[model samples]
Target: MRKEGIAKRGEKNKTTIRKILNYISKYKGMVLASVILAAISVVFTLYIPILIGQAVDQIVGPGQVNASALFVILKKILVVSLITAGVQWMKNHINNRVTYYVVEDIRTKAFNHIQVLPISYLDSHPSGDIVSRIITDTDQFSEGLLMGFTQLFTGVTTIIGTLLFMLSINPVITLVVVAVTPLSFFVARFIAGKTFTMFKCQSETRGAITALTDEMLGNLKVVKAFSHEQEAQKEFEEINERLAGYSMKATFFSSIVNPATRFVNSIVYAAVGVIGALFAVKGFITVGQLTSFLNYANQYTKPFNEISGVVTELQNSIASASRVFELIEQPALKEETGDSCVLGDAQGYVDMQHVAFSYEADKKLIEDLNLHAEPGQRIAIVGPTGCGKSTLINLLMRFYEVNSGTIKIDSMDTRKITRESLRAGFGMVLQETWLKSSTVRENIAYGKPDATEEEIIRAAKEAHCDSFIRRMPEGYDTVLGEDGGMLSQGQKQLLCIARVMLCLPPMLILDEATSSIDTRTEQKIQNAFAKMMEGRTSFIVAHRLSTIKEADVILVMKDGNIIEQGTHQELLAQNGFYTQLYNAQFAR
Candidate 1:
């Protein structure tokens, strides 16, 4: 079982490497050039030590030294060294470009994939975790990938070049150096395999910490209001402690590769030294040749040390790359093709038949539901929390697809219609307001990105937010922070209402849209919405029953099933769930 798990992990690592190589291969011409430069640089670099050895051979004794020949050899060595340096610099420059390009591609794919994922998937996962995969994990992958691209080829080429050069010098001593090199491989392999799992854990925990911090900080106001600061801190500390533990373990194990490979390599160096000395003393090879052989031994073993370090980076890279690939490869929401039906000039008709949907398969939320609404009808959905009121809006918007059933808009099945065209036909305003960091004019124009300034001000006035907008220092051009910084909750909600008013699509969905405003402002916005809803099919999910009393039909729901349906007066006369709900609100 243990062996099988390891084998699976090895296979996964290979897949990660293959995917990364595919991205790198897109710039293969540059990669090939860098590799060729690396090989050329290694060749010149290897020749320098040989030239030095020849210069050493020229020094027979102090008085017998070949001064002119020595100077010529020295000059040759200088020229080769200079050539090696220039080639390596060019190789490194190309490598940097290729590495960052690959990172950019991966990050782009990850972010694009997120946009197409189903709302269910987004709801199931933390935004911070997803953001970490796109930003932080990709960043980590790039660092490891950069290190690999920068060092891997050069280290490998030097090792092979040194080995060939040593073979030419004296094959017997070369054999001795080669014999102890396996020890370095064994050490690096054992440590690297363990570190991959550790580093992967560390990466996941970093994502968890990012998620926790995002959640805690995003709701810091709520946390302070509830006085849960200590509890939040404790939770953060627990995850942070876990992250530190994972990082320490991963770093410690990866750190071991350098020294461990060096230690094993030192033994190889010692063996080469001892054997080269014997070969020198036996007159099988000259002192100068042995000097070159020793240099080759050091060169060969040095690559093993450097490569061991690179392997550690490659392990972390593969781990991070796997995470990024998982996100990019997640099953995206099924998309509409070019031939998909488009909703053109929707008539505001909606029909839901035998609808059965659930966020989780084992737990049903909405089931066997049926509804019909004519164009221009106001259908008020009234229910307590978790009664599928907002969920019905979700289904109607196709944010969450019905598990089994048909939602027809204008008698065209929603499944057949292009999602963009279908969604474009509706304007939605929810209790939870969202505003990007932009000017007030931009916020109002969000739903209709190309709205004229006059149209924007008109929508703001309709939503009763124009007065506040004019009071700001820059008025329409005043830049707001994310989620409408410094704006009161009611003001932010008003801006969201204005955003929807700007579009005023043929169909509307108002889910507690007026819950945040003062009652006087709520009444004003309701009047504006009433005028806006004159000829559009509107689904109003409301908690304050009085606001929805004029709805053409009121559907009161409980436990995902609607039990009462009629005009508000008729439902009150029924004296059932809707009556208790309506009277309870007014009673308070």
Candidate 2:
């Protein structure tokens, strides 16, 4: 399993690298500048050794020291150092700009892509992991790009220039230096390959820790109520331990890379010195030449050490990039292809023909279902838990596609219309009301951003929440806590209804909209819902029979099929499934 995971990760890394490179292609000028600066810096660096050799030969080794020549060489060396510093600074500046913007572009695309993903994708992936990909993985890519590109560009230029200089002095010694290059590369590659798995594991474990922490914080009320503080702490400690263990393994391998490279480099340096000394004594090499060769040998070994360090960084980056790209590459939910058509002055006719759907293939949630609602009609669906009531609403909203049937609005198949156009025709108040941490007025006006104070108040009054809202210190401008934690469940539901009412869509869906309210509040909400449902098509999925008694149509569902359908009066008259359910409930 671990090997398979590593292989899959490697493939993903390759794909991500391609995508990153493609993004970078847009900033070709900046990349070119960086490369040029890097090459210039390396060339200037190579001059330092030559300047030293010239100083040794002209000033320190001859019968008489040449002061003028020494001054000229010193001036040249100073100029080269200054040029090298300036080029390196430019390289860093250009690389930083390129890396930062590329990361920003990728992050924006990833975030936008997430918004268009189907609800099913979110359902399958953990929220924490998704969040980590966006935040942590993207950060890794930024760091990796900066460090990796800098070292890679500089290292290659330095190695090439140094080898050419060494060969100029003594080809034999240069050959010996070149021979060790392959061995260093092989060792670095071996270590990198072995450590890749640890890096991946560490990333996964870190994501898990993030997810667990988020989950705990989100459900802090429940945790406190159950007094599971100790248990939660223990669970967190265990996750932290696992993450630390994987991190340690990854770090351990990374730490070994530099030292190992240095050791190999030390051996190479010793061999070069010994060989140069023997050649010098045999009159085969000059002292100045030997000095130059030694300088080049040190220069050559620097790339190996730098490359070893970068390999570790690259491995971590590749792991992070793989996860990030996986999310970015996920196919977005199929979008409507045709031009968007508005439902202007819509009459809200809806029909579902032989609809079939399943979250998974083997377990069908809604099967071979048929339903219809005329313009300006109110329909209610009632069933036991897991009986496809919510699934039906999901299909109507086009959140999920029907497997073997069609849903249509005014004879237009839903798939033929853009999601924005199709959904714009409806209003929804879900059971789990979601409110952003914003002003109360903003939350109410979410459906209509341009709504005025008067219009917002009118909608709030209709939803029966205006009076209570006005009593608050800040009224409509009051800032809500996360998910509206400052408000009661019933108040939150009322606010959600007000939000929906503000939109005034031709159709409204109330899925357990009254479940969170008390009996008195439910009555007020029912009145508001009735007012909203007037002159519109509406679907109500509720367990409460009283709430749907006035509905134009009621469908009794069981096990993914509608077993009974009629008006509330007609179903009661039949005394069948609907009648039995009504009796059992009222009998309680």
Candidate 3:
């Protein structure tokens, strides 16, 4: 009853198979080419059995054989076998190309869809889980697809071709052969039905283990620091144990399919051999024809075994594809459906009137909130944890939409403005810094990619990171690893600060921008920020009360409401929540 995709439990596999076929249809020319080659290879292969039966018949009297006729048949067999091998190789190559191309398209679309998904979707889903669907599941799907493409068409063609050849020799025996084939189908179908769910469960379990591995590896330092390594390992083993069970059950079911079909196929082979011998004894068919009929029966039954194996693999593939399509089908962030308004030349004025919002509808976090920032003012928001300070920053940047009311920038409704243009004018630095695997200079100039070397150096100097950059072996060109590898937390924070400094947008949002830096370095960064904020409207969200003493306006918030608003000294004089918080931070 478990569901991995948008469809209901019973309908998921069929829907995924149809979608996968749609993708395969995109490369019809290649698939058709592969099919043609498969057909050619099968025909040549089937003809070899006929030639083989003729050769068997020609050796009637041992040394008194017709050597010339036998040699001609042998030559035909050799030529036909060589042709079959060549064509089979070509077909395999085409199948390989088509399978990977389909996978490539699916992967590209999945990744592109991820970029436009809503913030809430990303927030709710684990990063490791998303990565597993895109990477691990996609790979599993490709393996299944490749197996399908390689065997599926050839098996079908061989079955039909061998059947036609057998029918030309004897109708009664062919009917008997055809009747027994259904048993194989029924057995394979019954086993396949049981295996799909297990394979799907196995695929899901693999993703869970991959998610755990990714989480543990990314935060290994934290695990060691907290002495939680053993706990993490235990948790991993439990998930891994489940994965093992699912895999074994799936393998067990799928493995029996070929042998089970072959068991049925053996019955068909026995019926053909015995019936053909009776016909030969009565001289109703020639010895050579009887021999060819028996060979044709064996050839015809072989594809059932192969096809059953294909069914097993396809089940696994469909399960993996279901997981992948689930990601690609997720609803994207609502785009600008109406005419989008442009916010040109932001003048550092922002207003929020009657703004009401919540992460969950039942719980109102920010209700009937109002704020106004005049041009060139420093508005520092001070609040305790969960007081909606960072949430306010998210609203300003339009990371989340307001549930009710309007937030305007430069007197234009923010909802009307294109998100790209609206957010482009504001430079933001959050406490958690992010840097890609690139050079130090590249990280500094991230916000303004085209900034000159002199400009980047000046920004780094202003942000107090230029000293460390010069000491590195490659100076500004030093290649950073993932998330500023080898750099301390403070150094990474400084690089992020330099990024915002390089752009120096019309407005700024700094949420504890200097929390990682030492006191002396923080003072230098604050001085840089002051210069940067001189003519820009800025919203500063700070937990440290000592950081925002000179703000033009201080907003003290509690339980999602701004209870006090004044200059820092005025708030202290009033002796309210702000004073109490300031005292708590400095308390011995």
Arranged by lDDT, best first: 1, 3, 2
lDDT of each: 0.90, 0.88, 0.90
**TM-score of each candidate structure, all chains considered together:** 0.97, 0.93, 0.96
Q: Write the per-residue lDDT of candidate 3 for residues 1-588, one digit (tens) a residue.
A: 234442475477778888999999999999999999999998998998789888878888858888899999999999998989999999999999999999999999999999899888999887778888888888988988998888889889998898888877788889999999999989998898889889889988888888789889889999999999999999999998999999999999999998898889889989888888898999888788888888888888888888899888888888889988999999997888478887778998899999998999898899888999998899999998999999999999889999999999989889899988888889999999999999999888887889999999999999999999999999999999998899999999999999999988899999999999999988878888999999899999999978899899999887887889999899989998988998899878
Candidate 2 versus the native: TM-score?
0.93
Each candidate: RMSD to true structure?
Answer: 1.4, 2.7, 2.1
Q: Is candidate 2 or candidate 3 better by lDDT?
A: 3
How many angstroms is residue 90 displaced in model 2 relative to the true structure, after the best TM-score fit? 0.7
Candidate 1 lDDT over 311-398, as tens digits, reads 9988887888888898888899987866779899999999999999999999989999999999999999999999999899999989
**Candidate that beats the other on lDDT, 1 or 2, i.e. the better one:** 1
Sequence-dependent TM-score of model 3 = 0.96
Query: 1 or 3, which is superior by lDDT?
Result: 1
Position 100, candidate 3: lDDT = 95
Query: Best candidate per TM-score, number?
Result: 1
Q: Is candidate 1 or candidate 3 better by TM-score?
A: 1
